[model samples]
Target: MKKTLIIAIVGILTFSCSKKEAEKNTEKTDSTNTVDSINTARTKINDSIKALNSKNRFRDFSGSHQFVYQNDSSPKYSGSINFTKIDGERDNYTLSGNIKSGKNSVTLKGFAQVVSAKHINFTGEITQSIVDNDNGKPYTRKGTKTFMSKDDGKTYRLQDMVNGSGFVDYIDIHF
Candidate 1:
């Protein structure tokens, strides 16, 4: 009877240990899987960037667009602006453009960010110090822009305007 009791206690302890070991293994496997998924996502983003680089699609881009600024009391003002994409870094790009406003030409310097293959955001600080060619009034604007692409990375469509109390500027690009 003493031997039998000892055996039963040992059996219970062994069973409990086995279950704990199994639980530990399960947790380890889950952690590994999460790491693998993160790596896979990083690889996919890298592959897309490589594809864009192979095509030279992002190098030296130029386009023309019409910009309209919305105001509270009056109809919006519309004018044309041109953009030139300068190549330096993937995260940031330079832009040079002229925006027409009330017979004035506003010079623009823009820096753009590519958050991912599907998202593009840009912010530009404009010098309103330009002498108005017609009205002789100085103009200034400061704004940020966001654009999204449904495609992998081929084209970027404007999303919204934020951080500026000036105008609703629309840019039309051909690429």
Candidate 2:
């Protein structure tokens, strides 16, 4: 009876030790995964910024367009916009500056984070009231632009424009 009890206790100890090691390994794996996710997000943000700063898009550009919100319920307001870069800045740099779309002028603030040379993410914020094209009155709403890019510093398209519109006009993104 004594020998049997001793053997049972040894077996339990061995099993418990093995279980603890397994749990530790799982924890290590989870930690590694979390780190990788964070790095990926940072890389995406950085790449987005670089793409918006491309000179090909902003090297003295002008265009007129209309925008509709969700549906055609809004009136179509037409407008022209111009874009130019600040003096002495790199071709592919962070974009946070002024823009003139139609009769309204506003400043743009942008955020970009990079995890590596390839992964990037970019976001832009516009906070100010501008004159409404339909009524010629001040319109108030915060605007944010977002996009993603894989290229080192090339073309970038619109990801999203959030919160704000007047007279159904397409946004002008120049410089």
Candidate 1 local lDDT, 1-175, one digit each (tens): 9999999999999999999999999999999999999999999999888766544334444466554343243344444555555453455566555556554444556876666666657788654322312233554445786667666545555555321434443332223
Question: What are the root-mean-square deviations of the candidates from the true structure over C-alphas?
Answer: 12.1, 15.3
The list of candidate 2 runs beyond 4 A from truth reads 55-175
lDDT of 1 at 97: 54
Q: lDDT, candidate 1, residue 18?
A: 100
**Position 21, candidate 2: lDDT:** 100
By TM-score, how accurate is candidate 2? 0.33
Model 1 regions more than 4 Å off: 1-61, 88-92, 101-107, 116-119, 127-175
Candidate 1 structure lDDT: 0.56
Query: What is the lDDT for 126 in model 1?
Result: 55
Clashes of each: 3, 13
lDDT string, candidate 2, 1-175, tens digits: 9999999999999999999999999999999999999999999998887765543432332222122122134333322222224433332234454445565554445543332343324445544334543343444333444433345424232344433552333333322
